[model samples]
Target: MTDWARFLPLSNRDRADDGGVSRDRSPAVASLLSAIAAVLDARPDLLAAPTLRPEVTVDAAVRELLSELGAPWWRRWARGVGALESPRPEVAAFADDALASALHARAAALAGPERRASIHDLRATVVLALELNAAHGAAIVVDPLLCGAVALDLALRSRLPERAVVTARSLVATDGEWRVGRGPELPAPGGAIVLFLAGRADVPPEDSAH
Candidate 1:
């Protein structure tokens, strides 16, 4: 199992998309691939099972992973999003029945043209990957400390709803040295708080934590 967390540094905030022009941001791709591999390797049964992370199933996550990974070009041909995301030839082309072939081809495709997809979309995949990684446990995450810190950093950077209760949270990771919040501390495994923030895991919010 690969450690998907250390694939990118926790401090990396420089990867926000820039006009969707073109750049090869391979780190996110590598990280996501590593995460997916780790997840599947540990629990092949999850391929047909519910990830229990809301709308996404592990299989669907794989399909979307390919779609998002290929968005650089297919997005242009996209007629609609969400439910209408399918029928895209690019995605269809990548969606080989053989999952390994699909993932391999897509990885090569990302490095093909200068037209790059959004790295944020890939990060979103990481969160979903975590939902899958939940079954795999700490082994899949090579650097839990870094992953936890990065996860918290990501939660803080994410846009919250208007008057959202989760805003300004001070989260502490019991398994690591990372802690953030001026108010009464909300402590848990660093990754769980992150999953909760993403609505991937159901963890109740504690007192003021920002």
Candidate 2:
């Protein structure tokens, strides 16, 4: 017996009341959740009031899981985002550029120009960049107006609606700056643009970006 197998009965019982459960009760979901639970248990501090502080618990759980999985520092840093959590409007705009940079990085790594780019791969790269930026409290800036719209679109679409709500406004470059809202003047064309998404402590307005 796997740890997940042990929890299947309980999960089934919980679902029994609602017409005996659906795919939600599938073994894979149970196993993954159980594994996450085990990881959280190993860190009591993160296990604090999971029901009351689900986001906090999730953040901690993700961080722990990333560490346990031996993910790279960048990947680990990016795990701070919770599903369904939205990025700040300002952050979303900046993320467009960052995502573009990540995409470019991926493109550059390919052996040949003819190597096709998968939207999924590009989206994953951007997602990682988004998480890393949030965790480090820093912004990423790519060179002037790199395919930002496309990158942002892919990143936003790639997110699981049940898990995260990342969104962004249109990015318009004028005099070498990507502008969003009246928050502050964007950096110069060649400078870095910081993202201050929703969950970040420094930003205001707690509405979900969905």
Candidate 3:
């Protein structure tokens, strides 16, 4: 597995060598991204709908991940919303809207009033997730949303390689700092990528977080 912890903010020892501030990582971050990837991998068809928000894509991903992880009941409800092979565009759009609203509400409730994330932030969050996937490769988890963020990034990276690289750098500088808590209640695995998105950074010569 990727040494996910090495991506977090630098420790005193780490700073002693790097001499700069770094981003932090948490378990919620890992689970959230993993969930996002699971959903997208399961349903590439969503990409055909350009009007949908990233959150809608995320909701689909989350539902698929849950089902794969043994939440069959959720899978049933999720399928009722809209299946990948749904025959009607109108029906699929309606289901997408419903699922997106549900996900927005749940994310808001979890974030609470203190750190309630805006739709814009969520949208940007999705972009960050996609960029990581692109840089690191989707299959390996890149040590890694918030929808088209990945799709859009992938498109740009493919067409304008240099510009896309520059944009990705700017994204890391801005989006990289934000962290997701996954709340304190969820039972997450130790050393899992948690509480925030990942960015482009040099790997340490040796493992540090363990």
Query: Can you give the TM-score per candidate against the true fold?
Result: 0.59, 0.26, 0.25
Candidate 3 positional error at 191, Å: 19
TM-score of 2: 0.26
Tens-digit lDDT string for candidate 3 (1-210): 423232232211334654432222223333354444454455545434322233443344434322232123444455557753322233345454354343344444444434433333333344434433443233323222222122223323233443333233322211222221212222221112221122222211222332
Q: Using TM-score, give the best candidate's number.
A: 1
Write candidate 2's Cα lDDT for 117-155 as tens digits.
Answer: 333333233333333334432243322322232233332
TM-score of structure candidate 1 = 0.59
When 2 and 3 are scored with lDDT, the better candidate is 3
Best-first order by TM-score: 1, 2, 3
lDDT value, residue 179 of candidate 3? 20
Q: Choose 1 or 2, whichever is better by lDDT.
A: 1
lDDT comparing candidate 1 with the true structure = 0.53
User: What C-alpha lDDT values do all the predictions have?
Assistant: 0.53, 0.31, 0.33
Question: Which sections of candidate 1 miss by over 4 Å?
Answer: 1-25, 38-44, 70-89, 92-97, 107-119, 135-139, 142-165, 175-182, 204-210
TM match of model 3 to true structure: 0.25
